[model samples]
Target: MPFKTLLFSKQDTIAVITLNRPPMNALNSKVYKELGKVIDELNEDSSVKVVIVTGAGEKAFAAGADITEMVNLSTTEMHEFCLISQDAYNKFEQLNKPTIAAINGLALGGGCELAMTCDFRLASENARFGQPEINLGIIPGGGGTQRLPRLIGLARAKELLYLGDMIDAVTAEKYGLVNKVVKQSELMNEAMAMAKKLASKPAVAMKVLKNTVNNGVEMNITSATNFETNSFLVTFSSEDRLEGMKALLEKRKPNFSDK
Candidate 1:
């Protein structure tokens, strides 16, 4: 299906999703709806082992939510709106395939929240990140408050949230908000390179790794270790594992079927 607010393309095992709202790519209800649909499509496509998300232009990954569309909502309407946004983003975070956020420019407010949902974030030198909802007399209704602290640290997350300030890509990298900062011109190339590398890994094991880490973080050490043990057993049963081990002894690269 075609999308009104997104551009989607697939090259080999990688799928790229571009937020298409012009200039700043301010996410609105339409964008969120289309994003949910796109995520659904990618989730069901077995051939797509990795997904890369970016914006239409170099100016912004997404500046934020569409303020014009959000400013007049009643309290109840706002609650429903937040729930809708959360649902869409949650689907992205829980996707079966790994996702990479290629942040080319400004990623603010809900934009920052969206980036956090991805498995990895590769930011360009021109990229700026922040949770600036406080300046608008509101808090981050997205997962910012929850995920930010977990990604960086409580002190740093609070500082950014309380100050409503934007950090440069280098600063973001130092704070652990981004995996790496590349030149703006090379952002997409770097993202595609990383995506291809991830695609080449054992698919079943990769999925299990993502599941374990995401779920384990919220569990106690004892329970998390037990969960990891179960996950290990599950991966051990895969044909890829047998092939991997056999290939090691045979002195050749393993051809994983993702079984």
Candidate 2:
């Protein structure tokens, strides 16, 4: 299917979704709608073991939401838009395969929120991040208020949200908002290399690992530990588990079936 607001392509077992509203790839209703559809397709695709999301150009991963469209929206319309955007992002986050955000430039407001939905982020030296909704006399409506604190500490998250100031990629990495930062010229290469490495791992174990960590972090310690235990036990039933152990003993690479 064709997407008006994005570009989708697959490279071997890795897929890439590029936000395509060039000059700034601002998130809007159309972008959200297209994104939802694309995520659905990718989730159903068994061949795609990992996904990499980034902006079309170097200037921005997404500068922010489309202010031109939001400037005159009624309160009810705004609510609907937020809900739709949240739904789209939820799809992205819930994907069974790992997702990485390759942030090349500005990631502000909804852009920051979008990157947060990924399993992790890899940033370029030129990348900039912020939750600057307060600058527009508004606040983050797309899980920012929740996920930001969960990533960084409460105090740091508050500083960014309250001040609406942009942070350089180095500061973002220091705050643990991004996994790593590389030179601008190496961003895509680094991201794709990581994605390929992940794709080559035992798929079923990777999926279970992702699920365990994502769900466990939101639960109490006791419950999270029990959940992890159950997940670990379940992996023993998978064919990959047997292959993984057998390959270890045989000193050969495991060919996981994701079973």
Candidate 3:
């Protein structure tokens, strides 16, 4: 299906979704709906091994949610809007294939949360990040409150949320909010290269690895280890696992079928 708020394209096994509201790509109800649809399409497409999400313009990945649309909304309407946004973001978080956020510019409020939903983020040197809802007399309605602390730390997350201050890409990298920062011209290239590398790995193992890390982080060490053990055991029955071992011994690249 065609999208009004997003531009989707696939290059080999790598898929890219660009937020297309130009000037600032502010998130609104329509954008959320379109995003949810796009995520569903991508999730069902087996050929897409990796996904990259970014903004359309040079100024912002998404500056924030659409304030004009929110300013006049009643309490109940705002709550419904937030729920939609959360659902869209949750889809990204639960996707089986790995996702990379190419943060080309400002990532504030919902923008920040959107990037956090991805498996990891790679930012341009000019990119900026923050959860600035406090300035609007509200809190992050997206997953910011939860994911931010998990990605960075409680203290640092509090500082950004409470102060509503934007941090530079270098500072964001230092806080562990972003995996790496590169020149603006190199941001997409870097993301594409990383995505392709991840795509070339054993697909089943990669999915298991992501699940283990994501689920394990919230569990106690023993429980997490047990979960990892079970996941590891399940992989033993996969054809890719056998091929991987055989290729290692044969001194050739493994041709994983993602079985």
**Highest TM-score scorer:** 1
**How does model 1 score by TM-score?**
0.99
Q: Which of candidates 1 and 3 reaches a greater TM-score?
A: 1
Q: How many residue pairs clash in all the candidates, one count each?
A: 0, 0, 0
Q: Give, for candidate 3, the lowest lDDT window spanning 10 residues.
A: 202-211
Q: What is the alpha-carbon lDDT for the whole of candidate 2?
A: 0.95
Per-candidate RMSD, Å = 0.7, 0.8, 0.8
Query: Where is model 1 more than 4 Å wrong at Cα?
Result: none
**Residue 28 in candidate 1 has what lDDT?**
91
Model 2 residue-pair collision total? 0
- If scored against the real structure, what TM-score would every candidate get? 0.99, 0.98, 0.98
lDDT of every predicted structure (CA atoms): 0.95, 0.95, 0.94
Q: State the weakest 10-residue window (summed lDDT) of model 1.
A: 34-43
lDDT of 2 by residue, 18-118 (tens): 99998999999999999999999988888999999999898999998999999999999999999999999899888889999999999999999999999
* Cα shift from native, residue 225, model 3 (Å): 1.0
